[model samples]
Target chain A: MPVPNRPDRLFRHARSEAIFIASFWLACTVYCCAYCYMYGYITPSRPLTERDVKPIWGVPSWVFWGVFVPWLVCGIVNVVFSAWFVADDDLGEERAAPIADPGGTEADVA
Target chain B: MRDIWRDVLSTGGTRAESAVIFAAEVGSEPKALVALVVFTIASLGLGVAANRFVGREAGFLKKYFLGNRSLGAFAVALTAAVMSGGTFLGFPAFVYAYGWITALWIGSYMVAPLTVLGVMGKRIGRMARRTGAITLPDLFRERFGSPTLGLITSVLVMFFLTCNLIPQFKAGGVIMKKVLPAAATDWATSPPSDDLDIKVDLDTGYMIGLTIFTATVTAYTAYGGFLAAVWTDVFQSVVMAIGVLILLPLSLWSAGGLAAATARGVHDAGIGYAFGPGAGRSFHPITLAVSFFFMWAITSMGQPSTLVRLMAFRDTRTLRYSMIYLTIYNFIIYVPLILIFIAARSVVPGLSKPDEAMPSLVIKLANPYVAGLIMAAPYGAVMSTVSGFLLIIASGLTRDVYQRFLRPHASEKEIALMGHVATVGVGLVVALVALRPPEFLQLIIIFSSAGMAAAFLVPALMGVYWRRATAAGAIAASLAGSGVVIALYALGMLPIEGTIAARLLPANPDIGPASSFRPYYLLGFDPCVWGLASSLVAGIAVSLFTKPPDEARLSLVFDDGPAVEPKFDPPKREVESRGSEEPEAPAEPSATERRNE
Candidate 1:
């Protein structure tokens, strides 16, 4: 059996990370969309009043809970994942310089 | 995000007509002009400084086009996040039209940084380094060893990018025309102190504004290349953040508070505005909600402009840091924007042109000079996006076209010069097009964005991650993706009367029969979902049936062994050779690497 190498490992790492992040995204979408659609989508026939529209910190209840709270949590999750969870693998060296004579420019190409 | 301007107004007219009419009414603001001029001058200065930085680098082509893959975290995050003119103009207009529901409409954007960077960043960055690829098409061509794929990718990128640029140039001109002094033009009649009474012919003003907009943006982009664009984007992002932060408190204060604003907004536009499905049933059912999430996250990964940023970051550390920065930045800009525009419903009520909400509220809330600075947020958006597009188009022309096919033996200096010329040439063409621009500005933006994403996303994802993906598969995927999007749009424009198709998918009456350029939302989901699905299927089926990619090429691009780190200070002779010839080939693979391949 061939030994798994850097490319294979990196691919596996990227795939696993992608799946995790996508799952988090799915969770946020379900909670926020379902919550807003259920609570926020009221019938127009019913008259709306200042009292009837429940608000927290000046934002509507659906917006506060569905959008803002999930948004805040997503931000926290993103920070944690980006800072700690996401690996810092070596990106590899840039391509070698050309084969030629001695004195020239092009110092910091990469 | 599917079509931000499709239903921008609850009334009947389009975004273009509303803009023209609004410009006719609101005369010029002198202080705003001064503020804009100051910002433009500063941007020009940055371009000059960036040119100096590029001049010192070795490979002018790589440095000019990809910043020598040296972008830091802040530059990467800001340039990636500060998308385009729509973020400020179309989005606020969207919020104005559809109350608080705009929150959920744009909510999926929260995952944008993660989705775009985390998934593709490391893979693309590594691939580019290994293949010595500077542009998106370069990566594809190098990986597959197929110049045909390169040419096709180039054509698609250039075509879609130009489509994207025309509307942005038009937007910049419209904003400037909105502020043109009534008495400045010969065909103007100045009224009393009341600005509402003032009326002027906007033809001359529009031309002047477009000319200035074209000159400033084109000059900076052509002069300094990629570094200039990225640095300017960083500067513009700061300006955008400041603009939003300043507007937040003032808008809230003007509307009494968020509570007061929400209450009044409900009173004015109805409770439907504050909730889902919107007042006009805009976000109906559930498919659209899911489609929008896909639009922002999945499609963003496909954009050449955003993908290029991934290839240029200095290290994985930069990528990680940028993700955090982008998350914070999105929250600061978007959440505040949702609050401010919600408040605008109460403060600047009964706006005929909903797209004018941002400027209208700014003028009403802040002083003239301050309003100009705040207006810079949108103007900066236009400039930053235009500059980025110019770089991509120019790189596609010079690197992907001229050097690759026409002049494969061309010298480094010749290619560098061509790069600058191409940037200017594309800008000139786009500016001329903007002079007699199509009526539907927003639709063009929508098409270009979706088309680019559709054409490139699946092929790109497979190329980087899937070992079995073939050149034929990528080509098939690209053609299928672009074809599907165009066909849907074409079918949407046709008069499908008395046909099964007509019954199945009818025209959106709001946009009218002849004028409706929107795609038929199959099952209420955006056309992009269909396009992507088609692309993915074609890529997989074609790859499975056709021969797999060449093993040698695959090994070259995806060798699994530990990379031989290049010495920062190469032997003097090697440095001299770099100037004279092509880069030296990478070291031969180890035994373990070959076994894995």
Candidate 2:
């Protein structure tokens, strides 16, 4: 199947979208980590950074990182794996086969 | 007086005796018999209506497996909520077993509707309307431009759906056994203590009940398609919610009030919250948060049935309403059930299994009528979920596999027929697997959820927001993520024993001892973590090396711009109007123009 026009533009758009998704995911991860710590999943400790300052139900900051970091690392690794697997096939040919109308015209069937 | 009451409550009738007692208690078994018949008839009628309605509106099979993107907010919200059987039945049971803290964790599912509403609901709704993407696999194919990815995703979804359905069937069988036992005259005279295990005659009443329930659900879903399933789900949700609420207060009153129930629970089980005593157990704050986060994330990304709802909506506004309605429904139905579970735990201590607690409590505490109604809730839940799963699987086979691969030019009517066939086929497979029930129904649900979450979550999410989310990447990630989780599970890495892995792996971690490590009992991590990790990594790495999806696809998927105005040629429209008046004039393309590829 023939590729659509504007390859470079498509590449750039795709790149930006990937980054945006990764960022959104990261934000969700951070929120979950903070919530977990507050709920008493880990032992209480002092804050390591300003971003960790918000305490929930009086949970300490250090305990937040204890669970958050490990989870984050695991999440990151998973994200990387997903990206790799999903990118295995060529998008153009795969997409084009279904939508592309070769020779069939509107008049032919009608 | 207390001893007599206790004896009455604790007596465990044998299967033969239980049948007689159940008959006597239920006032001649006719009411129970009538209820079952009524439920089956109602389900079938609604199901046929749903199927026919969708068929008429969608033009046979042109809309084919999908109902032509015609779902409203009410149907979609109910369908998504009812998809998870564990969420409905297990939440109350989890609360009963653990406590408020665990209930809080399970209650976090309430946040799911919000997550979908805030993030994916409107956006997907708009895109689905514009693109006419019927399934999540279809969306993946369109957005990322890859059929391989679509196929892989569909297979993964089917696998998850199958796994999810198994537990529902098992739960149904178990419930039937509990509710109806075979008649035996001699056993009725002597009652066994609660501690004694009562044998159930599964060949007669229990088997018949299970077969009828499964068969009815399967038939309608197979015949009616997605529309039938969704509409019936709304009714099921209503039934389930009403049943649970009614049982809650009555059960509490029987237990001597909420305070007394809590006091009893505290005295018997000690003062630990739902997450268990350890820091990292199932309900541990971190684990709960992570579990909920993953749950929300995975469902948001794919979940074919839920995505189909997005495709069904007329526009984004309707989608918004659906989200709001779903959130309210979850809050009303699920949250209060937690209290009921806790009350049950207080009343019935030392339950052999957590899942059995709610049923046991209802039988012991509530009157026959109330117990019957309450028992209907799980049946409703299981049926709703099973119907939803069967519909999706049928759609995948009919649309993704048959129409997409076998014959692209096949008419909509033909595809619809295929969908019905596929539904029956899938149902048969599920019922067969359910015959040999697993020891832990909850674990099976979790495993399936984790599998789908691992395979599709990252790729689907990224495909929408990131242009670089190539088809290759999505496929690779799904395969790797799902593969790793299954492999690990097979390798005895998880806490589970007696699985394929347990037989292979030596028991001793140090020197090949017979016993192996069970993660839930040892390390705190669930299989979901492993599946998620592998999927995420595979999705990202493959995308980095591969070319990104095209600008058109990306814009179609991610764009939040103003809707494009439909172009109209005045002269062409006039000609078409004139042509329409002529009986045999070549049909104008205008009517079919809006129909999506």
Candidate 3:
């Protein structure tokens, strides 16, 4: 029987998955740049308190929109990625190696 | 016994004199001291237990060095995630200094778990098993079929990790000193110079802390090896997590709230602390933010100690679990740190040194028991980091240097003896080097961590993924990256001055403003970025020029999933294991050094 080319599938999945996470990072970076450079009310150069008071989700506009919001998005993205990410594509081999670990031999804490 | 112990660690001044000076400097806080001592004793106890546990294992080298590759998900996550000094002390210190720009520095950390666990973890683990490799250099050597590569990589790792150890040692000393009650000299104000006989005593405090901390960690690590390190790391990580988790809410409450903290900052520092890079803002030229994000991610991914944790985990299941929990742990540690330290500025308004900000703020804000626990937090960080490095250095010495070069035919008993010796010896040398600490904790860390990542990043990744990654190419990349960093430190604008090497190198030529030409910082890039670029260029260019690594050679290690090889199997005839009876042909009988059963 011919061995299936599963590495190809695994590679594609891995690459796309990486891109999925990186897109979030790059998106945040772009948003930060726009928040600082494009916005009218806030500037990185001057003191931030000068801005007219605006709050989002119980945080000031300058912070809520710029920093903490992106972090919240990252947390959610990671949760989804962890719970449902594609991992360990089947190579269709009947007896693939069991990925053995020398687990209990040295330091098994009860 | 007390006098003997004091004399052994003495630095000219008497303990009584030092105590008096300490008294004058600050008030006493015994609760913090008691907390630190409890944590310290616990660390030493874990080390002792782990050493005994490892002694009975099948192979001394494999079991002691890699914990027999038996780590659970929780152990792996905690040990790897607790990047002691950097996360606990240096990170908070850096943020306290630069305000909201800390977010900019650590932004890429959002994707770090994804990048590290997803991108590198499985591949490195699979590779380690394929070659029966227990260390980073072993992987490089086996994959590339080059002893020269192994030797060079080992030397670079040891040298740079020693450089990395300095900041940790300094931070450990600083935290210890911070908690000690002020040295009440009882001398009058403006006493005469001879009559005063006074010293700043930070160095004295640092020396004492360094000796005790180093002694405890080094002893345990030398005894138990990687098992001891990981066991203690699990515990240390808990202490840090608990300490921080408890302190943040309490600190916010103590200082009123975020709004109140900002109000205080505006009143005193004349700028918004919570939302902006105030008057003393360090976020200039914008590129720094991007650079720091790259640094933490790259440095973390490439650190030898961190990579070892990846290889040592039980399986892919463990890797997945670690990824999830470490992400959550990082969120708990890092986000709260930014909030607490920003709030801390309200309490510690005139902190002259940025690094001292964490300890000072905790002392002021936290209740006695909580303050003590939090005070031990940074020490926990430093010890965990130090333990990891100590083990790696031992592995490098025993596996790469001693067995491969000096005694390829050495017995198991001999290698084990040497392994313990080298672990202790390396720890001692690092402690000595750390005695005279640098001015900025994070800057030196950047130079070392960044340089290390630049050197190993391409070689490590390409060697894993790229089938055509030649030994020559990997060599070129490692050389190009590390070589650039060293040259820059010697000739370019290094932070520390008054060196003999500085006198020898050509005086830095009068250059125009930073915009026109940044010689010291070439194109506004750190040595790390410069090194990374050079390595990429060199690795690619050299591989194209050189002969490709053999197809059979590539077939052994170049796989997407777990390698389909048994842990103790012999190399198939066509592929050829490098265990022949010569240096050039580099092979030997697998005696007691097989991976643990």
lDDT of 1 by residue, B144-230 (tens): 656678889999999888887886777677667657665554474422221111122236766777888889999988898898889
* TM-score, cand. 2: 0.70
Give each prediction's DockQ, rounded to 2 decimals. 0.37, 0.06, 0.16
Q: What is the interface RMSD of candidate 2, in Å?
A: 13.7
Q: Rank the candidates by lDDT, best first.
A: 1, 3, 2
Error of 1 at A16 (Å): 2.4
Give per-residue CA lDDT, model 2, range B1-597, as digits (tens): 222211212111111111222322343244354454555677789777876675353344324345555677787677766533344444544555555445334433444554444345544544444344567776776566676777888888887777667756655554444445345222343333121122223344445545766788888877776666667778767766776667767766766665566555555554443222211133444543455455554444455666666556654445556655676676557655755776775577766445556557767876676566545544555666678778788778876777677766675556656777888988888777666544333334444555676777677667655568877888888888777667655554445476665575555222111122222211334456667777788888998998655444454345432122112111232222211232222122222233432
Among incorrect, acceptable, medium and high, the docking class of model 2 is incorrect
Better of 1 and 3 by TM-score: 1
User: What's the CA RMSD of model 3 in angstroms?
Assistant: 8.7
Residue B336 lDDT in candidate 1: 95
lDDT of residue B100 for candidate 2: 45
List, residue by residue over B1-597, the lDDT tens digit for candidate 3: 222211211111111222222222223467766776787788788878877765463566777888877788888777767445346555665456555545545666666676666667766776676566778887787777676787899999988877666655554554455555446222223222221122223355556656776777788788777888898778867877887888788768877776666556546555534444323443333444445445555556777777888778877677777777777787788778877876776767767555566667766766767766765655565676777887888889888777766776566788888988998887778767666544332334445666788788889877877777888999999999878876775456444368886566565433211211123555555567677878888888898898777444454465433223322122333323322211122132221223222
Interface RMSD of each: 8.4, 13.7, 8.8
Candidate 3 matches the true fold with a TM-score of 0.78
Clashes of each: 5, 60, 16
For DockQ, candidate 2 versus 3, the one ahead is 3
| CA lDDT of each prediction against the hidden true structure | 0.72, 0.52, 0.61
Candidates ranked by DockQ: 1, 3, 2
